[model samples]
Target: MSEAQNPNATLSVAILSGKGGVGKTNLALNLSYALFRAGHRILLMDFDVGLANVDVLLGLSPEKNLQDLFRPDVTAEEVVLAVEPGGFDFLPAASGVPEMLEMDDDMREVLFHKLNKVFGSYDYLMLDLGAGISQTILSVAAMSQLRVLVVTPEPTSLTDSYAVIKVLHTQYGITDFHIIVNQVEGPADTQATFTRLSTACNHFLGFEPILLGGVRSDPALPAAVRRQIPLLRHAPRSPAAQDIVNGAVKLHRVRQQRQQALVDAPVLGKIPIIRK
Candidate 1:
């Protein structure tokens, strides 16, 4: 469907990573919270069907999930869980449901159509996609307006991230990407990590991803995770939380710029007439 026909023009962002254990989900959750706190209506959907855990991290026990939406009688609005205190919405995915991981063309189209209807009410839809380059992940990433790739300081993480980027760029033709360096030591580490990845991408893929920012390593993050609370709310002053807030601000600015660019672009199929 064309962008104008879509009811929800909400900015959709897919948060993904090349490998697991890179704190991608945590970053997604905290970033959603940060955006919500900044007065934006946000919906965080745990699209990691196999190991869905956004609710687990938030200590929420959602009775319904994306699985319910698959039923013909159910609607996407009914499956969403409104998080308390902040009023942000969370869409939990079905964990350990192998069927949910793979989707046929028809199913994929129906699911996204329902999602667009439900997400139309929100200003932002943050999809926490599963790690790696699964078909589902690539599909969702291709549809999203903003694609944020999370990477760590580890060599394996960087390599895997490059692999995913290469596939998306070459196979899916998705060149625009925003890189987030997670679990960093300091500013130098963040810059080094981003530079290494961007340099490789530029040399090979011929595209350089924008560095969204970095989240520093902090003890508070683990403690918050253990407590099943978002680090932003658990320890707002922590370095990691601060980093997430900064990243959210950058994301908002990028979204605005893209919107402006679209508005400024000239429309086709219009005829100009000379004035009398």
Candidate 2:
């Protein structure tokens, strides 16, 4: 397969968290939007299968979702929708489906087979993964080229985020964690929060995660969410939105570096994938 049909060029980035209410999904959505605005072909996959809400956040009602992709007749291209106003491809997941939550290895193989067909088409595959460490999430995070750990300033948030980092590092030797401190007060607060997490990682894991950037606490962020609008689209000038846009700029450069490295390096194996 050429780069368009394989994983050689496309950069898969999974934005994840250790716990809920840390604004993982929201940042995933906006950062993808910001990158799209920055002239990249982005495909934002809502991997929070059972409780998926990317569609709800974007105010989209897709006729086909990730659930439909599992059906033999349904293709990822068929289910993937073009996000309006934001102008990126979106692969939405089913919400409140019990069986989708308890996905087995067989089901995952089916999903990987389906997704592999479309992975090569985008410049960046922004995966909004489910919170906490599950088998499926662990595998996905491990396989992704970039694992973005979104954390807040709270002690519990840092603790849980460290737990995630430790698990992924121990299991798969994933050391390139890009940390983004969301809802921060300012640069000082962001540094403080990152220092705390970095200290823990350096002391225990012998690695420190890169501080990508921080999203300051902005009321417009929640308002955008409430109104079902992308923060970039809603209030691009807002503090949180600007922070995300800045992060996207840094992310774009990193992605270009990684993509070239992937092309020059060996190809990733077919899924079910993990242990990178």
Candidate 3:
């Protein structure tokens, strides 16, 4: 599972939103399960730093979290938590890890190298980032090859999403961004929200944000979260579950097309597999 052996490395994507309580973690949790069901080796990373709850959502409690990796002598392998049944592994970020705000230069290098060394093993490494645009969280978001900006129909959500795109453009100089409208009442509502966000990004951010699609607001989401199970398994026939599957398919196709384009292009200048 080392980088050298994994030539067809997994595509790293971080799910981020400008504000909290917009179903960011819900999307990340179910999306990982959807990808796993689609037969890809997936790794769901809880990179929430101070307040990670991916474990609670999944209904599993591990004695070890990412804190183990930060210890003086623990190896990288010691921190990975394997989720049962789905075969998708995870790197959990629980509460009270020392230096949670920022990883020092040495720690950053070690983490980057460890990720590079192991990321090639899977087809997708999905990071569930914390809400808000903190320096640490935003840095992690920018590092990913792809980003999923989740938003609702709320005015605050739209405003915060704009702020996130602005930060990404100014701080990381990233132009490739995708939008996913969540918690919509219906297709019309989804369109309205998407249009507003897209117009703002194009007019002000100087970039066109592609619509990655939307997930209709479903009552089953919170219920599943309470039960600590993926919505796909808890309510497979639900509208939201089906939408998640559709989203996963779209995302998978996008990644495949990008890879194929890289392969077909004769120049092959620099493949942007991961941003960094």
| Top candidate when judged by TM-score against the true structure | 2
Tens digit per residue, CA lDDT, model 2, 70-165: 789988889888885444889988887778776777887788788877777777889999989887677777767788999999999999999999
Task: Kindly give the stretch of ten consecutive residues in candidate 1 with the minimal lDDT sum.
Answer: 266-275
**Per-residue lDDT for 1-276 in model 1, tens only?**
544333344677889999999999999999999989987778899999989999989999888888888788888888888885554889999999887787666777667667766776666789999999887787778777789999999999999999989988877677889999999999999999999999999999898999999999999999999999999989999999999999999998886777655343321111122123
Minimum summed lDDT over a 10-residue window in model 3 is located at 263-272
lDDT (Cα atoms) of all candidates against the true structure: 0.85, 0.85, 0.79
For each candidate in turn, the TM-score is: 0.91, 0.92, 0.89
Q: How many backbone clashes does candidate 2 have?
A: 0
Clashing pairs in 3: none
- How far is 265's C-alpha from truth in model 3 (Å)? 15
